[model samples]
Target chain A: MKKSDIIKLLILIIAVSLNVKTMKSMHANQAEINPDRAKISGKPVASFHKFWADVKWMMFIQHMGSIDLTTESNSKDLYQEAKDILDLDPGFYKVYELSALMLSAKTPDLAIDLLKRGQETHQNKNDWRLYSMAGNIRHQETFFNKKVNKREKLREAIGFYRLALKKPGVMPVLEKTYIKTRAQEAHEANNDVPLVIAELLEWDKYVNTKMAGSEYGMEGEGGDMFLSLEENTKKDILSLIQRVKREHQNNLAGKKTSKAMLASLFKGIHTCNSCYNEYGAGHKFCTDCSKPVKVYGICPNSQCRKTHSNGKFCEHCGTNVKPKKKKK
Target chain B: MDETFAIASSLWKRLLGVRVVYFLTICAVSLIAITNMYDILMIGESRALMVDTGMMLTTIAAMLTVISLAFDIPKELQSGIASVLLAKPLGRTHYLMGKLIGVSWVGIFITSLISIGFVVIYSMSHGAPPAGLVKALFLIVISVIPMASIVLFFSSFLNEAVAATISTVFIWVGYSLASLNGVTLFDLSLFSMGAEAFYNYEIPPSYLLKGVVSALLTAISIVCVTSFIFNKRDLQ
Candidate 1:
């Protein structure tokens, strides 16, 4: 061999050595992050790992079409097939979702396990559906899994909803379900009025934020839906406060506390002194309490006579509309 | 070096013009198109299915294009084409290097064409593919270098049939070892971004850098080894 060829060989040796070292480290790095690859025996080898996962997904869909979902044996078979598919490609999001949903019918615990596995997988950590669905399964397990403590399952479901709420882009329907579940839990287990009110307000804030961030002049029907939802939530808050105030009216200090809470929820609405029912602008009496109430912010001009919410001047006629202070 | 480039361009044109390469590419494109029909079957996962199938088909087509040279090399040598070419101003090392560069160029070009078709089809069915998928396709292009060099290494010393078989077996073993996490000198699986794309996981830039470096170094080393072996063999 020529001397030049000798030098080439030497360089090749060094290059190969470097490549082997890099590959070994690469393998080690992947091992650290790669969850244990599914170990199903006899799976055919393909050029790409995900390709087989795709094929298995097709087979799974075909099997899904043939099975009767209500049958216990069919559920078990479906779960096993899902497990195998997940073992090959743990990142298959729909597999985790559909399988967990179906498996929960017969095996709630296994469904939770699958969703929890999905949650642990890095790709799924931010996906809100898995967490919320897991919560739903746990919540319903009160009836399905007789061994579970009802209160404990409810608390677990609430906890899952909280996690789901933190993720961006949660569906409005899921939020509705979450709030209802929280209220039901509070009513049955704890009757913690303050906590329940706080959760309802949190949902209110989430809806408001979503509304605020929507594209200007482009919210379309979405804006109207949000507005309606906001209105309903505010009414709920008002009713809850009213119930508390009525319960506390016998004690002077408790009545004062309830009044303060009610004032915080509504900026300037007139409250009936006799029964604490809220009345609108220009109303002579509270609608529910049927007691005379003071009115404010009526336009001074008899011609305009518009009632403003709370302003020194009427918005319609620019006339000063502040109510005169009563002489003590 | 000019002679090397001359030989490379000529061989590249020859390989690119081969009917078999076009046939393989058409097969891949048609199969990828058929994968869209599997939409009803995949339930919400049809996008993932199509993406995985498109990438796999691209890899196979590109690899087959480069590996064709494994058979072509021995035929050229037996036909005394290498001898006639080496009789000129070209060095044996240049001849081998030229072939490697030419085959790798064809592999990358064909892979890119199919990838464009895939991205279009994928976009039509399911919005634009994630950036990770594009990166994954790019990795497949980078992979052709080492693959072409592996074929050259085997074809240098062995007959066409044996050379193609060993080259294929070596690549298959590399992928199998990857599944087992076994260390290898040239790990082809490092170039795969299929799982990342399927899961919509962002591949770290550091990993991408490492993969590109590893593939290039492996290709360079293998080509040098082939050159050494080819230099000692008698052309007659």
Candidate 2:
């Protein structure tokens, strides 16, 4: 070939190569850079995954340049970028909702993370909905990670359930009951016996009774019935109560040696059960009377709502109840 | 008077007749109308006013240069008018150079008028065009140099009507394709890749490579082919 023809061929080759290289670099960068992962593990896993994902996402953006996402050609990249965002902040609720709706199983972690993060930040009714969604994902993970000693994972899930309980707004009573029950199981498995028993009793008295006719009640189909806690924590609580009663009998019989033991027993049981039930069981019960608390009004369902010296039934809901008053 | 200047004056008078004025008026009106529409719709970025004005200058310059050059040599050849013009005391190169210079001057005038009108109207409707408007206008004017040469080369042999009409349409289409790197083809290939990857991993298209490469190729082709065609063609 002549020198001029060779030069022309070289130019064409160079142009094609450059275009290909540009596209390849973009793809490589997108794959490498993701948003920073929620530093779930140690520093190395957090930093390495985050750095790698971020670099990939940045390169993808650079490769894409200024594309309008509304166009059909640009929509794919837009969706991918959104997935990357969810990967970085899995607790980002909106991102999870969008990714789940759009990409589904391809970005399940993102969807779960989006809901988790939404629960963490907003603390609103919507945030509770997201929290419940995250709980569903955690439930699935719990089932899947059966072989993986998931103590820490369960703890994290418990945190989200607690957030859902604290969130303002009306939730389906069954859903709220379900969240409280799961939280009780998490606490019991983690060695919170008193909390486990207290939550069991609370659920027995309130949720189980209210849900008696519904699918959410302990007697209903798939009703947890606090069965999981009954098998483990109930035994523990019974032993503790027997020990406390024996120590108290010794104190009443003028055995001064067991007086301190009785006081310690009472304090330990009260502290353990209160902390465990309130924080771990996911119930916002009153500290004084140990009744379920309500927002915006004194508990109308409590016996304290009546004008009598010691009413036996709640004036509002007409149920047998105690009359002691307590503040949140 | 200098022979070059005298030749330029006569050529200018011939080219900028009533029809040329009408064409320029239509171009100016269209430009203002488009700018008004852009302003009313608010369909662009913060620098839109400046960019639009710059685009208007470039469009007018391109239209004037291509129309004038495509007609200059062809009209002279068709009317048996070259003999009368060639009998004058000017070299062939000088006559050609003078005609190009006159055309360029008219192009510059049209560009300036449209650019100024855009800025003034934009200022009245919105605020002043950005501070970079002048620099943008200068860049646009400089960019049209290759376009002017293209029409001039085509005019040397083709008839005025045919050269003007064909080259105008062709140059616009070529510029668009070259700038965007055959967007239609790129999108068609993307579709064949299947929907999942297309929706999840596709990158946005950029024109840095397409614009530079296509412009270079078109410029070289025009220069080489124009030289070859001009040298062999009868100048009747």
Candidate 3:
């Protein structure tokens, strides 16, 4: 090789060696992500905030586009990063809003707590726009979580909005309108009246009655919402309950929902190979994830020549059976 | 001005056949595929995730576009295209500005196409595009201007591989710096800041004014410096 070629080759070797060393250092640094030190608060400085943002971004990178129960553990690091950001700079409303939105699904309580912290800290900092966000998150949680104690969350939301209304510059109209809308939402989200009423009926069967000669009252639905009635009201309630039970018995006997009929309606339907979240028979795609559903009768591999959806796999080539995509 | 436009048109035409354009197009389509891979609405603020992911991908596309264009500059110099252009009455600054605008055009076009694809895929279920998606697209488009300019500046002195590498490092560093909460030097923040501010609805008039100014001034400054360097350099 010429002198120039030799020099170029040497430079390449040095560059490669340095890159390998850098890669090793990066790996070593990555291994230092100890969850134990996550709680250590940094000083309220620009560098501290950047460090926290980096930590949060790391967590987000690992668990991007997922906020299901599976991603909850990753949310812990995000939780710490959020705390660090807030502890360093309480007026960073964007971080609070982002954390609240992300953590609200898997860990609503943590999400709620973060927003509450934001509200108090931001109030101290004299920034009142957070009131809208705090209230909105509460409502959003209630809307998303099927098992949410709607009354409690709604009340907390209202409390935030009320405090926001008291903030010097907040318009009365907007606050009042937000409260009204949220209150209406609370009513709707209280698990539909019929669903709650059905639970109350189930409670009447299993609670407030003697069991095996024990005159003990059991905890009922609606928490402590029910109470002892007056004499006349008690008599009327007893009669109404007896009549409703009779009607329920009659309806139970009269209703005709055949298992075979249901099977017929559900014929050829299948569950999603992934998630299994919303099953439908004969579905071309997984109803939830929109991926082509694996089927018992057809090969999934596009290269497989087998055309039938038979047994577990294609008999000719043994490709896993999946639903065939309709040709456009 | 006409000459500059001619140079820009020629540069843009050349870029049409480059691998970066295809890479960015695939990146956009890959985003849709990735979105399809998940039940995207599974998260809190599903809409927010959609917007944020799309914006970040566009920024990445912008970065790669800048690198691609910057690398092209060195290749042009080696191939005598720079010398041939200089043989004309064209000023160095005008040539630099043309290259800047051409790369930006390519960058913004890729970003906007990808943004539109993301919007369509995300909003197809809802029958309408999500709120702030258009604004995010505009921010990404704006952010690419400075990114392309920075890469062009690097290309003025460095060879292809070095220009591409340095451009990527600088852009990433700028993005990281911009993401810092209290960083007063907003000029380096790029479009990521625009994405954050607009998506979060934290944008005041001052926020937008500052972001626009930062992007414009950075691009102009980088172009000026690149032109000065190109004029001073002795060509073979």
Candidate 4:
């Protein structure tokens, strides 16, 4: 045989020989290391949780292994996993973020518990994200939950938001005006009129959507009370939502033929005589023209001009006519 | 009958004659099996990485099988092996199918051995995986065909190395689609689906069916088109 062909043969033989050796080595190692075999020899693999010291590593491996896509409430594996992660090292805050968000959609209480534990454990760290998250949770639960006192939850949420603001570099103004008004002195110093109507309407939608379900069942003591509050709240909020939506359209049209456009869409649009722009039904100012808007038609006697009624009953002399109820 | 048998036998001989591919397969499976044995030390920790890594190793062995097909078929035609087969009573279509069948046997054998190694090692850590997980792996095995058919389809017109490269590229294209927002084509991603289902995510039946069925339909279409085209070609 030529030298090259002879060498090729040698290489092939050597490679096959090495492959066999490697397989043998692998088998020997498996015999020594296989969990089943080890169990027979009095060395069962230690249970999963015993390695709490390696919680970070454990969580990392567990998450790496599976991110359950199915949104099943029964799968509390993520919660247990998150708790373990926090228990071993309270600093794994990322776990709380993911775990809390996923858990909250199903179980708000556990979600709050996780965030609370995280907050207490990492208090020294002064993490604003934690405080912001806690506040948002309480705020959402105020609407989502009815078993709790709504006013107290709202107050707690406000407190959390305040704490978050005091933690340095917080911009409370970006979120909502109420927090901003409470937070900044300069906000009050300005001549800016607060957009209270718009804010109230949004809160109305928030309460309506959550309470539309049996948030806190109607069977208990405060359940009926909560339902009454929600009913009245919704009634007030719905009227506000309609009013704001109208004013919003009128402002966009500005002072130019806004009433004509508004009259085409809605029948009872309150137009500004000063600027031909429309306002909400119960407004006090021609918001566009800066003139007095609420020409109160609130009088019971027709002969008094001292209490001016726009066009309806006289505030000083005519009988007040309540709006007729629409048949459903 | 004698001529067809002779043709298939010749094709098998040429594939078996390539000592290097055989050695590579053995080496790949051994490496995966051994590394998995070592991961057993992690004990009660997630046995997922073992399955995930093994799935990757199986893909490597499948790739080697595919790359060999890229060169082997064209090299056979260039070296007058095709003429010898065509000289028989065997038709052009049978000759090509015989070659494909030979390639499939090699691919299935090597991939199966590698998959077994993965199962063995994973079993050592956490006993037998669920039947559904095994089913996903089997689907991965089936997904390999659509890719191999692509290489075969390309080999009908392109150079051997180029055919293999394009086939590998096609597999990667199916894979990268996973990063895009919605339909990640998990079932079509073959072994990746197994790795994800076993080690990463809970794959639902609807998703599995959609992916695997689409991939199988694709392979059947490609194989048919390539065979018909090859049958019509006039060899130089």
Pick the lDDT winner: 1
lDDT for residue A40 in candidate 1, whole number 0-100: 21
Error of 3 at B105 (Å): 1.1
Task: Say which candidate scores most in DockQ.
Answer: 1
What DockQ values do the models have? 0.46, 0.04, 0.02, 0.02
Q: What is the TM-score of chain A in candidate 2?
A: 0.30
- Residue-level lDDT tens digits of model 1 in B24-73: 77778878877888767788666777888888888887678778889878
Off by over 4 Å in 3: A1-115, A120-328, B40-45, B179-190, B193-214
Global lDDT for candidate 4?
Answer: 0.52
Cα-based TM-score, every candidate: 0.79, 0.37, 0.47, 0.42
Better of 1 and 3 by TM-score: 1
Ranking by TM-score: 1, 3, 4, 2
Off by over 4 Å in 1: A1-5, A21-47, A144-147, A171-231, A241-261, A270-278, A288-311, A315-318, A323-328, B2-10, B34-39, B77-91, B122-131, B182-184, B197-212, B227-236
lDDT of 2 by residue, A179-287 (tens): 4555455455755344433343444444334434443222323442322233233334344334433333333322232233234323333222322221122224655
Pick by TM-score: which candidate is best?
1
Q: Tens-digit lDDT track for model 2 on B1-236? A: 36667776776676666486647655665655454554322323212333433354446455665477787778777786765766677645455555555665666656666667666765776676554354334333433444555676678778888888876765554334312333321111111111111112222233223323333343344444454555455655
Q: Locate the minimum summed-lDDT window of 10 residues in model 1 chain B.
A: B174-183
Give per-residue lDDT, candidate 2, residue A254. 26
Candidate 3 residue-wise lDDT, B63-157, digit = tens: 77778776778988899988899789987778888888888888888888887787777767435763445654666677787788888889998
Error of 3 at A188 (Å): 35
